[model samples]
Target: MFTDGRLLSDPGPILARVRHRGSPRAFVFAGVQRVPVVSEEVGQALKTLAPGDVQLFPVSVEDVDERFFIVNVVRVVDCIDEAGSTGVQHYAEDDPFPERAGEFRWISGLRILPEKTEGARAFMLKRFKHPIIVAEEVKEALERIGNLGVMFKRVTGNPGA
Candidate 1:
């Protein structure tokens, strides 16, 4: 794992589709840049973001074997805690959603269905698809994160050897 964010827990199975609905007001301000979180702690921290809370985390990926990697977790307290915290929009101190903070369990699944990220640009994914097919650079990036050499060798089969 890259040493900065202190995210990325031990590899685990993750659901393929996740739902992290973006706030409409944020869309109005920042377009489509949603900071991806990997670990539950980071997800908890990120939940405390309003609009201007510019934090970063690693992008999640679906590896070649159908296992999910780098899932971001979310909860209600963090969202409620973030109110009026100088984000894309300002919420009054009344913070209309305090009641929502206890309504559900923490949600941590997979990709936000149809969300995009900077790392996703390194590969190709069509809508209605299940697997994330890798491009050249993306394959290299995967190698950096962990060994996928078995998959690579199975594909290449000593093409140059």
Candidate 2:
């Protein structure tokens, strides 16, 4: 996994390549830019972050199928154990939800639905929250997989293929 601030700046190029192939489907951000924190541990792996870093993890569509349809895993770091320590907390301390740490709070999976498959589509649509920044690279990878399926069907002389 490539880790650095440059990943965020031009994720477009990396994403584009991923879209073309059905490999390296996952992408993760190691820091949350514009956030602040007291120690550097939070920003070590990530770049251009605020106070802390945010990581990204990406999974390929093909891998999901091979693994029983599990797509992605997202882990957010935003918890502090304040054992009665009266330390000065920054203004941005309240920005991240401390209640949830080491938890997969974001999108975790994506499944392919057959065309016109209302039941399947409905389920995915509900699971995927709106306003999601579905990167172009991800979209491209999925599209490539779709095209492969179509090709297989035509060649095998079976729509199910």
Candidate 3:
């Protein structure tokens, strides 16, 4: 979060570290998916949210892998901006171009730190070579999901605790 306490989860920088920081490093996929689009059942299963708000479906990444962390995906917005390009997708099926693919959803997730650990401190101190842009709605949803994670941590001693 910024100093004003707006939550954020910018995957780009952390991912860059995984790729460029470690020695003897092998490239790993962040495991993007969109096999089943959000249906009525899925929407209802998640909460009282409307089906239309759920542009991305639930992905199962529920294990402690050496290289992966289970990040909560809160929202996926249609990138109509990237319309005319070729649809070489990572999350969606063969559909990178929104014009041809119907809608391209960019993944945004929840992030938090209890009190800036060593890793968090290192991450914050790192310099960024490029601008990592995420959508506004996606950021808001991530903040909401992050608040839920914080609540869960307090109650159940789960995530972020």
Candidate 4:
């Protein structure tokens, strides 16, 4: 949902205010094709994409119709502070190098279209901190999926929406 001019800034506050829960472990969104990774992985990947590029982060779930899901693309800025390092160590018990400083902060989280909702594209643009740019490859992938008529439906009452 990032617009055309707001790249290279932080999208943290907007993400924190979102009411949705993080994606559940069992309902990984990998099959969506348009969205290729888990939220954490997506955050990591954003580090390489050009700032302001729009990218969709798909979340998959069962018991919902196939036409609704969340989709949004906004600029991501990673801040790897000491607290982030602590979080990583806590999550990954077998820290590869516990003695060394852990200096890796991920995309943290991002904003996307809520499930069963429309206007996400516009919403992200308006709320995002920076101008959004859609990566050429990502845009092409979306187009390919659109041509195939692959759509998603939102699931109400789902814990991880």
The candidate that achieves the highest lDDT relative to the unseen native structure = 4
The Cα error of candidate 2 at residue 140, in Å, is 0.9
- Candidate 1: regions farther than 4 A off: 1-124, 148-161
Give the higher-lDDT candidate: 2 or 3.
3
State model 1's lDDT.
0.27
Candidates ranked, most accurate by TM-score first: 4, 1, 3, 2
lDDT of the candidates, in the order given? 0.27, 0.24, 0.26, 0.32
Using lDDT as the measure, name the better of candidate 1 and candidate 4.
4
| 116 Cα displacement, candidate 3 (Å) | 42
The TM-score leader among the candidates is: 4
**Candidate 4 worst ten-residue window by lDDT:** 119-128
Please say which candidate is ahead in TM-score: 1 or 2.
1
Candidate 4 residue lDDT tens string, 1-161? 22222333333432211124443331123332333222433333343443334444333344432322233444343311323222232223356645433433222222232332232222122322222323444434444433222333221233246
TM-score of model number 3: 0.19
Better model by lDDT: candidate 3 vs candidate 4: 4
**Could you tell which candidate, 1 or 3, scores higher by lDDT?**
1
The C-alpha TM-scores of every prediction are 0.20, 0.18, 0.19, 0.21
lDDT of 1 by residue, 1-161 (tens): 22122234444433323343432111111113322323333223333332122223333333322222232221111112222212223223455755334332222121222123322312212221112223345345445544221243211122234
Model 1 superposed RMSD (Cα) = 18.7
